[model samples]
Target: MRYRDENKVLAIREAAIDMVASDGLENFGINRLAKAAGVSPATIYIYYKDKEDLLTSISIEEGVKMTRATLKGFDPNMSFKEGLWVQWQNRAAFSLDNHKSAEFFEQLRNSTYKDKMLETINDEFRKNMGNFVENAIERGEIERMPLEVYWSVAFAPLYSLIRFHNEGKSLGGRKFKFSEKIMKETFDCVLKGLTK
Candidate 1:
């Protein structure tokens, strides 16, 4: 058996994310990733069974990290407005600070691996979000609505803004910059639309 090195694993994971985020999953390949990680193809096999295994493992790890970051200091029992505000702040910070990982997730979600990855999403994330929505409806802080409708209204705008920020351009080819004030203003509009 070959000895496994932690540094090699970290390098492989980081290079995989950077390559996936920049060149996209369609263009990604194991040989290319091995070169980028400064490890032999066989070395990658030491840590991952194959390319699919590598991608799935990295995606699952990143998903867990994202969930932890987004749920930090958040409480499902909080008022709808307060809870949502916390979520927005947490999500924005995580997305911006780890834009490459965020981009990798976006690509993964749209790829064939999405269904495979979805099966491994942190159970606590689903449970907490579910509880948060139920609590909000029961408290009369937000109207009762389908989960899809609620998610669309509550989080889609934030994601759109983040996309614009990542691209550094919005509609009409205008240069774009993201700011806390802009995020807060957008959140207010979403909050208004969601409230009872």
Candidate 2:
């Protein structure tokens, strides 16, 4: 087996992220990424054979980073409501602060066909959050349903809100105004739907 060059791979990844942020991923290309990273185009080919390979790699990296960030500082002992609210707020805060990352993730979600490699990369995130959902159900705090359903309830709405904000949607007349109160309310609503 060949030893993967970590520094070269990292450079290409970083350059790809920058390109995606500045211009949408559609505008990103291997030649442009190589130029941005100060490496030969062959270097990019060495790391990733094509644009799809690079994009899959980028999606996986961003997914892992966002998953860790979202689950950061979560306390296992907190009440289900409190814990869920904290999770919601954490994700919302990350989305607002890192719009580019959020957009990139949303793009991946909207893709028609799911790549196996990308799906494997997203599994850790599902597993982590599913643990929390399973625990809550085991304690009779929430209804016993498929973890995917619970995840959709918890996260899809938040993702939609982030997309709305990114598109410059006006939230005027909204009582929560995208504050803690809003996060709490949204979490509570999701909990109500999930709970018995």
- Which ten contiguous residues of candidate 2 have the minimum total lDDT? 112-121
lDDT, residue 86, candidate 1? 98
lDDT of 1 by residue, 63-125 (tens): 888889999999999999999999999999999999999889878988988986786667898
Q: Report lDDT per candidate.
A: 0.91, 0.71
Residue-wise lDDT of candidate 2 within 1-196, one digit each (tens)? 5568889888887777667766765676888888999888987887787998878877767777777778788865566787787788788888888777665665556553146336645665667666776677788887776657766987787776666666656465343335566556666687788777
The C-alpha local distance difference test score for the whole of candidate 2 amounts to 0.71
Where model 2 places Cα greater than 4 Å from the true spot, the runs are 1-15, 21-27, 34-49, 75-78, 110-113, 120-124, 170-177
State TM-scores per candidate.
0.95, 0.69
How many residue-pair clashes does candidate 2 contain? 0
Q: Residue 163 of candidate 2: its Cα lDDT?
A: 63
